[model samples]
Target: MRRLMQIACAVAAWASLSLPLSAAPTEPENCPGLIASRDALVSRAALRQDEVGLTFVGHATFLIETPQGVRIATDYSDGTRPPVPPDVATMNKAHSTHFSYRPDPGIKHVLKGWNPAGGPAYHDLTVQDVRIRNVSTNIRSSGGGTEYDGNSIFVFETSQLCIAHLGHLHHTLAPEHLKKLGRIDVLLVPVDGGYTLETFDMMEVLRSINASLMIPMHFFGPSTLNRFLSSAREHFPVEFSNTAAITLSRAALPKSPKILVLPGH
Candidate 1:
């Protein structure tokens, strides 16, 4: 009887060890839940016709509008607001100008990049025609130490396009980070020589991502923006737009990667 009891206890221990860890759930690049609802959502939004509109809102902010009339403001803060209230707003608290504590009550979804309680900030939800998710990255703290998961690279997927905004990124991306990003069609990046990654390092990141369209943001003025543009011209053809807004579609993407500079709002 004693031997049998020992055998039973050992089997129970082995079973527990074989069980998968449930403490931390792994978030996939393309969440299955978001895909599951696509059929229902896509059928309703006939206006998009496989295209989306992107408008530069200045100072690291861009307004993304989906075909189904869903609007999203990236890096939303007190400094900038869409002409009309956005259905969703994604903010990175890297600086006072990138995030606001008091957002308008009319805005529906407000996503923050940092987890104040000391964990990775996680956002994985779909609203209307746009599905939004985030990959957490570290930032430099005011005290000068590294703050882990202090920022997020927000990705918006809709109309078969993946748009990513690198919010206050300070370091080069790791292999793991790239894996989470998947395939990015359009990348809204910071071109400020010093505030974000150094110009050369930022260039390296741009090459690594190999996005089809690179939009410069967070630049103080034309001088810094021009410097990045000259370096980028080596790889991507530079195009300056007189307007702040541009409509994009998968079918109409440029044959090659290009750096598109848009007027700040």
Candidate 2:
């Protein structure tokens, strides 16, 4: 009975969230960080759209390919590079492994999550057919103190899918953070219980976001990944993919939230 009540509340919360755009979503300079409802978004059960490809490039890096061919690499660093140079790359300053001091000059856009002087880093832009933006979040500094706006939750909107990557998140999200994220159909999250949010807190985040698909990243090994999967299975269906990449479309998203564990290269 308790589990049923929890699920019921989750469903009610999901219904209350504002849906994405109905027509081809506009490319705004910044994500409004608010939800808006329209005839199209309300009337359509599924937005028929082209597929977006996501390839896990190891560690926290994932290469996202839009239907129009724009490619974005998340948490880009020197440790791993996409087979092809990404048109845009978003990096977080959580650690050396998450950002590169010397990025390839050929890349057109390099977005860092933190400002060198310590203010929040902000990015809201459109490249080709995809819209990219970020919400600033704090991280634990190497000195064991809180670093304000040291990380970012980057969102990519394309093919009618709102995909967010939570970069090296250290704490549970605040109400303001949830408002800024709007509706996330897909979420790329760090699952290392110690390095990122602890297992229970991470589950809370998953429940709060209520994303259609949850992809686990940044786990050190199978043991850590397995722990997350076991805990998450209670609320969300889990799927294991042999390959590192998956193609998704808004129309094909699972009705209930699902966790997809993609093999890292």
Candidate 3:
């Protein structure tokens, strides 16, 4: 009986060693250093918790209002101004229409996407109720050569959501860029087939980011917007909103990825 028990124990040990090791559980992707607790968020006004308001202000600009009443304007330019001065304004120099030489004096923070000193523009700061950061990308120069670090992809973190604005993105993202961006809940992309990336390449960018919601911007007109929508519909459902603004929350995000077109330029 003792010898039989020893043989059984040896067999069990061999089987355990022969079996393949179980794979480690995968961790969910998230934006680093952006998550904030409810206690950390300051309630400044009537906006509900975990809610953000976004309004298209024509062209590539959009006005973002946080639950804490913090206001931000993207691609801020003289032509596309918000109803009032924003608390913070983010600008890109891809075109004069995407940036302003002189922003409103009342604006508290003016973040330029490109460095005039000839390097990548860097911005990582926290305002009243949100944290804003940037990942630099290249743009096409006048001579048609690669302009390294000429553009930036600005990200806003608030109300438990990460929103990214792809400013004149000229190319598909690399793995490193995706790593830095982490998990984006909403993506504001430029869909002009000519000025920015072509339709197919822009689609590739959309796929790589894989945000829960996508808002198209920078299209010249209906023809341009239609061209992008037709291509985008093949991969994701497209929804048209009659209103120019929308409120979003983490709990209300679409179950599947979707493209939401707001009525604006």
Tell me how far the alpha carbon of residue 155 in candidate 1 is from the true structure, in angstroms, after superposition. 0.3
Query: Which tens-of-lDDT digit does each residue in 101-217 have in candidate 3?
Result: 889999999999999999999887889768888889999999999999989999888778888999888999999788778788889999999899999999999999888889999
Model 2 Cα lDDT, one tens digit per residue, 1-265: 4533343343332222112432322333222111111111111111123556677888899888765677789999998767677899999988888998877788899999888886898887789767788889999988999999999999988777788999999988898888777788889989989988999999999999999889899998899899988999999888765446556666667787888787762
- In model 2, how large is the Cα lDDT of residue 219? 90
The local distance difference test score of each candidate is: 0.75, 0.75, 0.78
TM-score of each: 0.83, 0.82, 0.84
What's the distance in Å from true for residue 207, model 1?
0.7
133 in model 1: Cα distance from truth in Å? 0.2
**Lowest-scoring 10 consecutive residues by lDDT in candidate 1?**
31-40
Alpha carbon deviation, residue 56, candidate 3 (Å): 0.4
Error of 3 at 107 (Å): 0.6
Clashing pairs in 3: none
- Candidate 2 clashing pairs? none
